[model samples]
Target chain A: MTIVEQPKASGTTGGAAPRGALDAAALRADFPILDQEVNGHRLVYLDSASTSQKPNVVIDAVSAYYREYNANVHRGIYTIGEKATAEYEGARARVARFINAPDSHEIVFTRNATEAINLVAYSWGRANIDRGDAIVLTEMEHHANLVPWQLLVQEKDGDLEFVPISDDGLLRLEVFEVLLHLKPKLVAFTHVSNTLGTINPVRQIADMAHAAGALVLVDGAQAVPHVPVDIEALGVDFYAFSGHKMLAPMGSGALWARRELLEAMPPFLAGGEMIREVHLRRSDWNDIPWKFEAGTPAVGDAIGLGVAADYLTALGMDAVRAHERELVAYALEALPRAVPDIAVYGPMDLDLRGGVIPFNLPDIHPHDVAQILDRYGIAVRAGHHCTMPLHERLDLAATARASFSVFSTNADIDALAAGLVEVERIFRG
Target chain B: MDDLYRDYILEHYRRPHNFGVLDDATTSHEGSNPLCGDRITMQLGIRDGKVAEVAFTGRGCAISQASASLLTDEVKGMSVEAAAAYRADELLDLLGIDISPARLKCAMLSLETLDAALADLDASASPAAVAAEEPA
Candidate 1:
């Protein structure tokens, strides 16, 4: 039975599926790549924060797209063409439904979340923001969120301000309120920190930004895969996320924006399929999303992403979130005990964070820790995790991050704990 | 078989050699690996066309710190010209460990810093200064 159709357990936080609700091993079985051995040991993948392993269904969906309905979208009137077009647009619609976007046309597929963020910063920022206007962001944002705004701020000669994170790694909302006093033209931030895994209160921040007459754009790349996100409920102007992080193919992501906002912004990329009437030099832009989606999209990847969404929906996001939370909770407690002097970053409160744990061992560089763990067939991401600014704020050069997905189990955490002991033995012994 | 953090490498990381600022440095340069945030400030006292003294101070991964420790030891008595021409492979040879491509930058940051220090010394001291001071 599909996980959503399974009897919903009514007890966890927000009625999140209990730890035992979703069978971890069964779900792990869904991902063919996770079953293999690495370095003569069972591959315990803790790098989902980087990119998730694809499930059989998602892999087959992409293969099936090229195998069967291989045609360009939106122009084919023939059977396979119509089928391809239907599938492509149907993927967009599925993304829209996944995020609870009011309209499917509001979702525009891009290469990845970085491209999605860049699309808004260029198309919307150029049109609306004037030179020297205040554009506020947080110190905790991934470089994707930071660099795009840096480019925009430079182009517009805009004043950029950052909302700093507190010692506990949560956003200083009061400080964000203080920055709103700048009456900023835009407030862009991440929904969850890629490094700290702190779940920013999107709705609260959106309310504050709206009160101060500013538009909010959230980098939902880390949020969409692990959390139950309803873009409507988040009440933000723009939401961006990647397909690769959520059991989908790489090369496919989406941008969800307010219909009116997308209607107003200029097209980001101009080419065929995004235009209505082409003259010698100029052409009328296509509709809300199509106008922005210039050239041919990654049709096969999009179909795979759509199936991935179905896979997640079938498993239910609440169960996914709950499953990861259980793993994180277990790791948070187990890691420090397993290896002394191990410092874990991000919130300790279960409700306040996602499954990411950026950490360090005394006198041990994250790179060394990761290298040692590799021998034990444990895959944890090390380094600044594309959040150099966040690392700077934390006074850390780099950190080893152990992030969890739905399929991660207590056994995986145990393996991580055991692997870390070996790192200590090699380095500290 | 490719055990990266061997005992000696870890020992170098734990108790790195000449890991302090040189107040008498003739030239100094700081090099960094932006990917891993490994920074090394290498200082050298150039005299009689030789590296009379060398020291480094920075924070980084074990690979980088240990590599710097080994590099400082290797270049302390080497001529300025030879130190400037210190190749990446030479440093890898001293490491005596197979550094995967990902950690190569970490392993090479030392040589990069030492080279930068020598370059800075060459630019500021001028070629004649080293030759003129060689007899003294």
Candidate 2:
């Protein structure tokens, strides 16, 4: 392994806080991976939209569950099994409380947010939607939220309509209101766009969709990590988010739907754990949430996710939001002045966006920009970001996206700005 | 300058050769790098089992466009059989840069599209070749 020498003036720590609210330097220490150097410079991770770096608490929680109580949940009668079952179920309860679900039984654990959306698309979507019915979506949805419904609508001979986004990257609410007249059965959208960081008006959209008699599903994969999300308060029928994006281990996420909706929908996956009794001819399902989770679930990761929720709750989501907003505001102001030809996408107003900043430097492809940034030990994502339709609409093949998390500091954004200068020097010089 | 984005790669990317559609091309194939949305379409005019003319048109990153630019130049006079037998490593070696595994597809996209166009030629040449090309 290559040992990277820490730069003397790396600015790994020591930044003035906006309101003395979030001590990002101290919080960065909690994540062991952030302490290291990359390519002779301090590792500046700006890919939280892909997956977040885990803190020691979440890591320890997962390891403790496996080390102390390693057994299958909801099955064995032994002491270890019972302990495992308690931890697994306890994680479900934590998820319920984290999202403000009406009942713990409404929270169903899946592999990730994608699987959770797929569960609703296949189970609830198949049962309710039929021929000539319409399902509404927005242009900014990640493929996870869009593709499943597309497949369902195609199979059921249903119409899949999309509400367009403006050039400023905000969804056209008036177009959505017009689409609601189609009497669609569902209206699904992302709470926060993974690429543009545009935060949709979830509550208002949900109310409009509800008035139109359409069920709402909010893809909160990007929202729950950076902002305070209350599913019940949003009044959405189904909400999905991933644990890995929230400082927990992968293979853990939750789908919080209405209890009546989950109870009425058929099981997405059928297996031993989800079935109460199985015979050669037929079988009976377990319950609302259990019916959705089949086979051996990711128990340890769920426990780790529970610990992650506790960590976020301790820090408080409002503080996380405030910290990121400060960083993003600094970035939005700094990037344009630092690189004159830089073209940034999404709303200029901070209230209309989140921590993700996707932009393009003049005369440089996003891939080359990313490669050059990698040399400066600044990691950023460069691709279509699984929202190809949005890219097409924006008339861009790809853009360099730098996303922030709780551990992100203004210093990291400074590194990103300096790194783009290097990109300009290398590409245009 | 970075080793991957060498002067030659940048020159080829900025002023690509044979980077327009052939109106009278005999065969054409298009492919896209789904990860980055880099697309390339290769057109070939074959005569007497050799590539009489070749052209390409698409939008992509430096690596992919340069690779396509370099590939059309290399295969202009080569036989269809030689182009079909072209290896991915050979193309990477021609580029003369260390490519990460993630961007290997970008560097090899032109070759894949060229191979597909050659396959299309083979399918059009004989009925037996069409049967052979079909997956079992």
Give the range where candidate 2 chain A is weakest over 10 consecutive residues by summed lDDT: A5-14
* TM-score to true structure, per model: 0.95, 0.92
The per-prediction i-RMS, to one decimal, reads: 1.1, 2.2
* lDDT (10s digit) by residue, model 1, range A342-415: 99988889898898988999888889889889888999999899999888888999999998887889999999
> What's model 1's overall lDDT?
0.87
Candidate 2 second chain TM: 0.91
All models, DockQ values?
0.72, 0.52
* Candidate 2 backbone collisions, by pair: none
Q: Give the TM-score of candidate 2.
A: 0.92
The single-chain TM-score for chain B of candidate 1 is 0.89
> Candidate 1 deviates by what RMSD?
3.8
